[model samples]
Target: MHKYQKLNIQKLYQIYIYLTIRLLMNVMWIVLAIFLIILIFERVAERLGIDRWYKLSSIGWIFLSIYWLSSFIAYLDTDDFVNMLLTLLAAIFSFIIAFKIIIDNRKYPWKNITLWVTISILIIFPFYKIPILRDFLIDMVANHTLFILSSVFNASGEIITDATIILNGFPVSIVIGCTAIESMAFFAGLILCLNAPLKRKIIALVFIPVIYIANLFRNAFAIYAYGNQLFQFGIIGTAHESFFWAHNVIAKIYSFLVVVILAYLTFKIFPEFLTLIEDIISSFKKDVDK
Candidate 1:
């Protein structure tokens, strides 16, 4: 037999063993995370310190739990069209990644996490912007986020646009609970889950809101741009599309780029954060190795 064929057979055997073990361990991890989350919630509620932190953590945990549950349910409910489609997609992607990992002999098993995160963000971002999906998730997120923000800042929190938060008296509005936040959190959480460094996770978390805020300011600035370009100078109807395009697509993409920049900056400026993240990775590595 050829060397490559031998390697392939060995890899296939290793994958079979790994998958069998992973099925059991995955359940354990899910159960353990759930138990710890519940314990943390009880402890936080009992001893009042940083109520906002607890609320945020609670929201995070709840959504995570639901996500896990939904994914599991999705696997089982093969009869429904949506469920079957989702399951098929999941299977295809999972198999592709698994095969790639086996063939590539990657140092870190979790390296494909970024790919999965990107896929998830692409799936979610469109839904977040589309009218029907936007209304549903935005309403839920905004209401929950507004309740948290109001309780924390004691402001009249109301969502004006898709992500804009309006304070009753404040002239400038704050943007909260947007798709940007969801996108960041998803990517960050995925990195963290994949046993990436803590600094990257922190960078991801920090940059999410930065993107949202930058977009908000961009919108505000575009208002001035529109007024100056159109009303103040010449009333060119066709030229006004420049203002609209600037306000819509360009600003949004630029803000996303800012988030990418911030993530890069976090790694450069706060390099030590990686040590802490590596420690976490080491701990998990120890467990997996054992």
Candidate 2:
């Protein structure tokens, strides 16, 4: 046991030394790259004027990245005044944090930093557009799911041509923004951070449409129920209460439940899959030793 401990200690020491050298080299490269970029910018500015060059500096690049991220997130589903205000506030906070990271690292040249910044921006753009995508995908899923559900429920009515459901003279349109695309986008970021496998990440991608489709049908059915509310609203005797308001809440609740259920399933299955992977690695190591 003492000899085993010594071996482990020696292995760890070697790894530590190797990593220390790698870290030092990376830092040196970053510093050198930054200095070279700044020198080039300074020379260019000498000919182009200080003001114009300053606008294209490391600081300016950070500001642009921050602005782009903030503006993109801020633009999603700003329908409700309260939601619009909240999104704007969140965008501002996100920008500040991202900006600080870049500014604090401004010792590096703009060019070296651009790769990382640009890569992040590219990654985030698709997710930022998810709310909009959810709307369209949800509507498609909901409308189709409603048709299926209608068949199951043995309900009879003209299926409206667009994404609208008409019942008892009440028509409700399933807007794409009403889908859970935004929430899935948020969860996608979390899963990505967890370093989930490509297959598992693909599962999350699949869940987006599943959640959206479930939401779409939930909305459609709620509208159907709203139209047939002679059974439900008869208890309240509508003096023109918010048409479909209760049903809208129901649909939203159903979508939330669906998201929770899918997320839970993903979490459960992913850990088991990881365990399987670990087992495989163990088997491979044993084979190598043999």
Candidate 3:
């Protein structure tokens, strides 16, 4: 009886420890989100150069805080879909309010809009959890990627399932994060933020397709190499066997290089955007130096 009672005590203690760790983790996430929101608010207020911007931003921050806190708690409760929807709604509402406030302020419209839009995109992009939209994007990416692979490799590639391409009987699954939507969205945000003519901005949007194509090419090449066992030899062989290094390191390096080249070409065409990019880079450099 004493042994069984001791065992029960140990089990209860373990459960208590597990619950405490989970609660702490959730609290940490919420705290980090709050810090990020506060930083964004300060930046926006400074950029707007108005005291009212702080007040307006505080309202938005409140909405965001509720979204973050509730979402974290809901995640703990395992209601992920509802949490995502609630978070999205809250973020959109906050964005609308903040955007209106920025437009009303009107002092450096381009800069303010750019900052708000970029921050808004960064904030809400990760929380996207709509099932239908996710499936649609995956389908599009998978089908289009397989088509491109077939055209490039002169080999038959088919979509074995949604977000999965089968090449030579090897199945490669493409997740939402791997679909190049994030890169395209980032470029779009940058273009929208540019202090350029409407025509120039529209012209800049041509790079979106370029980025998508580049990503498709990257994915196709990596999948081909992986399927055909091309990069399976040498020092890379061991790493390739481990999935993380294979896809994230080798594959991501290639894709990042492609993006860098594309970005260079883009900046060459829209030289005005380079100024902003330079300023951003210099600011980062200064921060690092400090």
Best by lDDT: 3
Q: Candidate 1, overall lDDT?
A: 0.48
Instruction: List candidate 2 stretches off by more than 4 Å.
Output: 1-139, 178-194, 230-244, 269-290
TM-score, one value per model: 0.35, 0.45, 0.58
Q: Write one digit per residue (lDDT tens) for candidate 2, span 1-290.
A: 69999999999999999997775444323333443455457667667765434224344343453444445565564323344455566546434433433434332322333433333333444534466654556566556756755775555544575666666677666554545555555554444544447776676667656755665566556655666663355545572233434453455566658867876776675774344335545544654697
Instruction: List the candidate 3 regions with Cα displacement exceeding 4 Å.
Output: 1-127, 234-246, 281-290
Model 1 over residues 1-290: C-alpha lDDT tens digits? 99999999999999999997775445424433433453346456547663333222223223334444556565574323443454456545544433433343332332324233433444455554467776665555555555655554344545676555554432222333333555455545444544456665665556556654554455444433443443333433454544555454455567657757765675564554355457546645655697
CA RMSD of all predictions: 17.8, 21.4, 11.4
**Every candidate's lDDT:** 0.48, 0.53, 0.62
| Order of candidate numbers by TM-score, starting with the best | 3, 2, 1
Could you tell me how far off, in angstroms, the CA of residue 219 lies in candidate 3 after the best superposition?
A: 1.4
Against the true structure, whose TM-score is highest?
Answer: 3
lDDT-sorted candidate list, best first: 3, 2, 1
Candidate 1: regions farther than 4 A off: 1-102, 107-133, 136-183, 194-204, 223-240, 248-253, 269-290
Least well predicted 10-residue stretch by lDDT in candidate 3 = 105-114
Lowest lDDT 10-residue stretch of candidate 2 = 105-114
Clashing pairs in 3: none
